[model samples]
Target: MDPNSSKRHLINQLSPEDLKARLANESFKRTTVSFYKYVILDKPEEMRDQLFLIWNKLHCYGRIYVAKEGINAQMSVPDHFWNEFKEQLYAIPEFNNVPFKIAVEDDGQSFLKLQIKVRQQIVADGLKPEEYDVTNVGQHLNAQQWNNAMDDGAIVVDMRNHYESEIGRFANALLPDAETFKEELPEVVEKLKGKEDEKILLYCTGGVRCEKTSAYLKHHGFSDVNQLLGGIIDYNRQVETEALENKFIGKNFVFDNRLGERISDDVISHCHQCGSACDTHTNCANKRCNVLFIQCDSCRAKYNACCGDDCQTYVLAPADEKESLEQRLVFKRGKRFYKTDKSA
Candidate 1:
């Protein structure tokens, strides 16, 4: 009997506990990776289904979003099938020669299940086709070039949301105050209103956001605009490989079970609960209030990994009551509570 045969016959839907147990018992390791490309697609739904089928067969699991604009993917593939997965990906005309940015640190459980969906846009910058020409993006700087730009005192901008940038970023980078990519676009443009002609550099987690942002800045008449090619993940990898100066301090916040990867030994951010110097991000344990926040070890033990007293109480409630409360609160305020500008 083949071990992978059982997985092949398994259905997509599985209870969270069952999925976690299965992943734990698996013998082989998985490689986590992410990649994105901006290219035209005629039928994203068809493409999504095809990719889901192919990736599932390869024992891959993660979130994937495809659109007419392009595809954005983050997945964990079984180590043995990695080459086959890449070959199949390259076989597709659209994804041919696409560069994948492997995760800096992976625990083989970044995601529990496979999910591929079709969306309107890949990175959701809230710009209409008439608003900005994405093809007119700024210059792409490799690791060394990016470091040089930083040394030359280029105005660096972090194109990620406030929560994402709160944990880590390039030293002196302009951290935007917005919550989503949509809001960040306009806010960043306004911030650089007077310095359009100055040398402006932009970066994000995986370079996808900066790709759209640089185009937006250029469309708004920024003369000298550049983006860190492949963003912080690639930058960290290059810095380690080439022994270059790592100007990026603290952990790089990522969207996975491993919330971040340490680029340097600097803990630049403080815990939200205790105000202790920490860069670790964690979601509230209370299902009703799964707000993302920073917490130190002491705070985590005190709050039981919940955000506050109310959340701790909710999480400690009976299972049946907890589910009921979660339904009511999530329906009323959505799944997560976002801090307002004043509160933030």
Candidate 2:
């Protein structure tokens, strides 16, 4: 077999349990970081393979997506190899000096293995090539400038999904009831129908989403579009360093194991169950119906870490009845699961 193919086989053979065990035995600390760029690539698959080999050697682990458009990655690097990792990454012409958004809170075990795959686009915006000029993005505003804009009553919009923004956002931002970025673009355009000429600001978890969203807004004739420089990650760092007023409240939702990081001392959202103040997000403990939802500590204990009473009951049910129970149930509002068709 070819050398690269042999290595790929070795990598593919490691199961999730194997990766977890390996991570548990590690003694060194790791740093979680993320970065993205919209530069064009000639061969994304080749680039993916090359990066996997290089980063795997350095013991770097994170979820990464590469495409003809560019790369979007969130990974953890061993502390000792941080400098070497940066050097190797920046050596590539397309990614040279690409700004990194370091995670606000990191325990180093955010990812257990390195997984890279080639996709059509780095961030899925559901747009055609000729639909908009992505390079024509909004003005980048640092923490201080963003605060100033907010003080001046600038129209701020959360470019992320409803789940993300539900946990945290800038004060008074126009949040669209969207589940994905694909849905958000058109919704935002429709929401600000009369204010197309207004100074609109867009922001997301990292700066990646806004890079494409700002351009999409511009294509729809929104003038004076701006985005928070480096999104909330860098904004938090700057706010702490410069002693600027933190206009954003609540947690900054992230995609890694650590679901979110605190940017302020406020919990703007409530527990989806008990309605108590909470911003912590977790997937339903029921592996079969792993819906993402929020629960308070009390509720978490009451539901046995599942979504609600129904899921908790199912979890406690006999193994043989699990499949039959699940097949006969449907999701309900108060109780996550309930009997619908008894045929099963």
Candidate 3:
């Protein structure tokens, strides 16, 4: 059998449970890294296929999106193959010298399968490209500059969604209550309507969202706009290494199995189920009702890691009965599953 075919067969044969168990027992190290760049791509679909072949061969796994605008990738690569992976990535002219933001915490289970797709936009903000010059984004501020700007009382805004900022954010940062980036841009503009002349700051999980948002704001005539150079992931790394003041508190929400990483020893968010102060995010155990929500340890045990009592009861039903119930619910409600912003 071909080596690639054998590897594919092995991956296909393993169930999610089997994959999790295998990850737990594996001894090799894996590095989780994220990076994004906005540059014109002539053929994103072809690029997507090429990347998939390379990454899959190296057993790399994560979510990667390629678009005409650029590429946004959050992937886990085996430590032994890390150098080779970087070499191949940098060989692509557009991705040359792209900076990577490594995760602060790595458990080697951040992703279980390699997925690459071509999309309309790498980081969707629902903005027309002709309306705003995305290349002319906000000023890039390092950790020190961001801290100084905060100390100077600049109008800092968390450019991420409500659920993202609910768990962690910079002190005194204006967090818009919008759910998606598309909703956030307009709402943020409305919220800071009168402060167009004020020095504005923005940040997001990996800086991709901020890159677009800051451009949007600047196009709207917001003066003196700045953004954290690499977002919170890089900010936390710099804070620890440079001994800078950690202004961000609580857990930084991440899109992976880990859900989040502790930036500071503060539980700033509360459990949605019991209202206990907790920052841990978990998806409902009942897959059909996989709502992402914060849950306390006590509540986790009581509800079997479910979102509510209703989901808990659903989990208790036998497999055959559960399937029947799901079908009935789908017919009655027009959908078997519902998701929220909290959904991972």
Q: TM-score of model 1 relative to the true fold?
A: 0.91
TM-score, prediction 2: 0.92
Order of candidate numbers by TM-score, starting with the best: 2, 1, 3
lDDT of 1 at 25: 90
Give the Å error, residue 41, model 1. Answer: 0.5
In candidate 1, how many clashes are counted?
0
Question: What are the models' TM-scores?
Answer: 0.91, 0.92, 0.91
| Per-candidate local distance difference test | 0.85, 0.85, 0.85
Per-residue lDDT of model 2, residues 34-105, tens digit only:
999999999998899889888989999999999999999999999999999999999999999999999999
What's the true lDDT of residue 8 in model 3? 54
lDDT, residue 30, candidate 1: 95
Count clashing pairs, candidate 3. 0
Q: Tens-digit lDDT track for model 3 on 134-252?
A: 77889999999999999999998999877788899988889998767898999999999989999999999999999998888889998888999988999999999999999999888
Residue-by-residue lDDT tens digits, candidate 1, 1-344: 88776445433778999889989999999998999999999999789878978998888999888999999988899999999999999999999999988888888989888888788999877788987787899999999999998899999999998878788888899998877899899999989999989999999999899899888888899999999988999998898899998899888888878889888888888888768798888888865456788889998999898777667767778877876665544321223333321222
Which pairs clash inside model 2?
A: none
Off by more than 4 A, model 3: 1-14, 327-344
How does model 2 fare in lDDT?
Answer: 0.85
Error of 1 at 94 (Å): 0.6
